[model samples]
Target: MIDFSANMASLMLPDGRSVRGPICCEDDIRRVIGQVADAYGFRGFLVLAVPDTGCNSLEANAIMTTYPVEFLKGYDSAGLINGSPVIQRLRRSTIPFTYDAHQLARRRADGKGDAAICVFEQAGMPRGIYLPVHDAGGHRAAIAFGGDRPVVSNDEMQELNLWAGILFSKLVEVRERDRRGSGSLSRREVECLRWAAAGKTTSEMARILALSEYTVNHYLNRATRKLDSVNRVQTVAKAMRAGLIN
Candidate 1:
């Protein structure tokens, strides 16, 4: 869990609105949605993390407004994500869109819509806007704000898009940091990899560190195993990508 209370204590919007909160833990994601919903005058919202490759499988990480647990379970069990019209439209477009629940239900009535539409309808989310987010790494995600009445304005939708993108990116960063810490790479192994990344050979690293060549090789091999890399080049690449080594 991350304590983002301090950072979110005073968030000022360009439209002269202020939002303060103590957003902490995975559960706090719902809090964020609620806050945004209140600010935008919406009844509910959902933040979904969909991988660029497979939109059908949503990441374990997500935030949603109040909905029955069984509703979500049934949707997932039915694999409704694969047939979601919103996701299908998002895949084809680069801009945000608005969708009406009643329209979706009518379209799906003929068996042309996804089963997920029923889940949303049951939850009382009949109207909403979809914001597509693209990160620097090319990962795609989306945020949806749902309400019985249309409360989100064009400007509010733009702001919500920015806020959701930042929040999702921060979540990814926190997860990555946790993963690296759990890897438990040793100080010596990281040090050796750092030097190796700096173009230092095993012999050169050994001399510079006042260690035997065999010891340096041992550290390199250990790091390689820890990173699950088949060779030194791959080890260096993996370590660098993980920010374990420069």
Candidate 2:
């Protein structure tokens, strides 16, 4: 687990960097989310807006996520957002909750839940905690932490719930700022991000683009900075969200 201390005002990253309050950008929020997940024994976390009655796509509501890209694809493809028992619980409950794949599967009578559970289990995250939250505009959203460990205690839930609120609130702030002051990516940067989103390695991208690996990395790095992202993953996520790349 990651060793760190955090408060409403500041967070100490595992690498000893101090992000003192007010997460200013996507990169800062990503670091905060990663540190919080590690400190809580989770493999990764996802923050997304809860779809209302008219919303049909998970990708449309996703805020930011550290979950594997493939896992998300499978989850959306399986229609788990609407069919999964955990989501059912999320819709009705205001309190934080913990669930495992089998627990949810067993609750369904038609046995279709088993298929959904399989998709979740394949992500290597069999259990997780979910915290319900609201945006500044009062729209519902949730934060989830998933891993292989047993369910967390109520005390742990309380702590995580507090962290979730702070994180989500800061997320709203950062996203608003990002949208208001978004930067444009160059054509080469957009191409690099598109390939990176496709799971291409730097070397593979270089070969495909007929550029040196160093040149590919340079473009990616520059794109990352332009997007105020910490790494390639965040860069791709941000670029995709901004409609700069598919």
Candidate 3:
């Protein structure tokens, strides 16, 4: 079995910006998250945007959702469960929560549960728990410990959120950096280019990054203009030459 506890310290992205260490591609993203899930013995994971995230562009660094590659590929793209109360609570609240699944079950008895969403997806179902980290701005993401038992309890929730908060806050800073020198690329744009250099297609990138294909392409195009490159491949090469994608 792979040991993830040791690997946790090395989960940052390549720029040394916020991700614990150098992770350059989707494989790296998947590998690290997969490790976290395995270490916690959770069923799956996801990294995405909270609803209050103020998006300036359709291709902004609004979110980066990750799950088992297969599941990500096959999940109902229609956002089948976006309106469930559990997810709504996940979004609006930054204080960690320990959902009383029994409470929810009782609510269900009174015809209150979202039947299509299932107990597995709900944190208060008495079986799974969602370990969420919500930034002060309400941009949040979560890791679900949905299996035979709960991996995240209320106490553990505080610790995990504290750790994740530090990492994500740094990421948001880099991704949304201000314009300068008449040619500034935000950190998110730089990251997208770096991944592209490593051969990640837009759709593949969208999966690792909680974004739509159009959004991924938007970051690429913006970065390309900033670097004055004529095309995607050229953009990648130029980014390398300028120390943007090393």
Candidate 4:
């Protein structure tokens, strides 16, 4: 949702260098990402959406990366993001961490290893540092810089962490701005959807909100209609994506 062509006419980096010109298309975004990756001494980069609490599912369309397109397609086809050990670790830790492909392969719960890691290794990127970011509302995301070797220096890690955090914040701001442009959901609808997104049942939500079960279902059904979602789960997901509910 970033209007890169409008907002990113030029970007000034911390190093005092200017990244010039508007990002006119998807290829331009990729070029900008590649430039940023090179500036941080990385061969590839990824932006991943962190799932909401108690939700193991990741949004399929929420990923952006400078990795090989075919490899990314393969990873999606394999549905590896749901079981990604790197993302699981990031969810538990506050600080950025480095990971090797082998370590990730070994950490899979199924013990069969992840096809994404295998693809990354085959693509010559075996290790990387992951920088996690969370907003005040508990919306989580991560920016990862992948390379052929580990980033060993603590100072470098700290620097990259700061830069990545800033970049991710900007991206989040853009997404929120775009979401705000959509038709607004009412307060009760959002409240009900938030609880639904948190995995609460209609009866539980009714109890918590001090509303009748019928009223709770009404709010949810209204939200679902507004979001054009097929059901409660899809409604919650759409609401989250639109920043209408946390």
Candidate 5:
């Protein structure tokens, strides 16, 4: 578990009325969500992520929060609750997409396979607002709320998107800079690093990437040396912290 003592709640308030937020850290992600949930007396908050590649064997390092463990568990196991239409668009596009009664009402009466509509229709979700967030690499991630159903008017949505883009974009930019900063590792080296972070062995990585074990080892070794890691696991951890891996 991460430490939350640093008072880590420093998220840019998606709340329009007030501009106040506490300091945040990795651990505070949950605490902050709890605070938000209490503010509106909502059911829960869900955080989902899209990986750089592949659909299976993913790391659901995401957090899905809702009242009652049963509800959260059901929603989580159902899979793709995180990848609704609203979220898919948010990741690919440079805008924050909103899902609520107003937006959903505009869709065809037949529902025609709109992702957000489908997700909202799911059994466990609380009927409310959903926001899809994008990171610096253009990968999509999202947060869904189950509660009072906050509405984002056109003007509010525009304003939120503008600052959200800036806030998240900068966070991603810093992470990417850290990723690319390994004194400038080659793309191939970075790829190796990413696979390693996912707990792939060197031999496995070589087989997956179609590269020789020697080349793969060389890349990892060099990267390790560049990163000044004491060992392979340490190297991987450093790479992840530096955003060299997902």
Candidate 6:
């Protein structure tokens, strides 16, 4: 666990910059979020773009995460996000809140099995807190810290809120900086890159977008070249770094 008092003391410098040092890249943000989560007694953290609608999967909007990949895959497959009380509350409320799997299961009316809740239990993260923030464009985003710990006190919540706000601000700053350096990507290209990053194949992307395989390849290839990447994998990395695709 981090020394919370010391961390707060180092949070700001004379000029208002982070005393945490320069966040030169996304990995820096991930590292900081992970370390902070552990200090707060959380086992995992996720930073994601909150969708305008509840229909989107977690994988589609995730910016950075310390959650298990297999759990993410299973959660997406379960298709319970739209029905999740946690997600619904997140969409409507700006205030941070704590949630548990049982509450999520009881509050949902979708008539689905407890697969999603079970997954959470199996992952050993039955409870967590969600802190909402926004990007430079005023788009809503959130940071979630999950663990089996007891509810945080008011003082702790206040500290976490300040940290989350500043962390997300730094994330937007870094992404904007990278985006300016990269060439512009078309909407179609961005769509293809997003799917690719989600682990979709060319054929799958084509089917999902109602385009031909040739067209999907065309868009992806163009995006790759525009980003000056050597291949699809590298293209995804570049697009992610540039914030072209979340």
* Candidate of highest lDDT: 6
Which one wins by TM-score: 1 or 4? 4
- TM-scores of all models? 0.56, 0.67, 0.48, 0.57, 0.41, 0.70
For residues 7-53, write the lDDT of model 1, one tens digit per residue.
Answer: 44355565456655554433354456567666776666666655444
Per-residue alpha-carbon lDDT of candidate 4 for residues 1-246, written as tens digits (9 for 90 to 100): 222223333544446666676643333444566677787678888777776445543434235565655555566566676677776777787678888888778878765475767777776778888888766577677877888865547866675666566566555564465356436666677888888888899789978986546457756775676687899999888888877777
| Regions of model 4 farther than 4 Å from truth | 1-33, 52-61, 114-117, 181-246
TM-score: the better of candidates 1 and 2: 2
Per-residue lDDT tens digits for candidate 5, residues 28-128, read: 33455555555554556555564333343122324334344334344345454344344345446644455553364355343433443444445334354
- Local distance difference test scores for all models: 0.65, 0.75, 0.52, 0.67, 0.52, 0.76
Give the per-residue Cα lDDT of candidate 2 at 90.
64
Clash totals, every prediction? 0, 0, 7, 0, 6, 0
lDDT of 3 by residue, 2-82 (tens): 222333354433234233445543334545554554555555445555444332221132244333333333223323234
Q: After superposition, how far is residue 136 of candidate 4 from its true place, in Å?
A: 3.4
For candidate 2, write residues 146-239 as lDDT tens digits: 9897799877887678778877877777666645655966567788899999999987997898654645775787688779999899989988
Maximum-TM-score candidate: 6
Candidate 5 has its poorest 10 consecutive residues by lDDT at 1-10
Regions of candidate 5 where Cα sits further than 4 Å from its true position: 1-24, 29-42, 51-72, 79-84, 87-92, 100-124, 155-246
Tell me the lDDT of model 5 at 161.
38
- Global CA lDDT of candidate 4, please? 0.67
Task: For model 4, state the Cα shift of residue 180 in Å.
Answer: 3.7
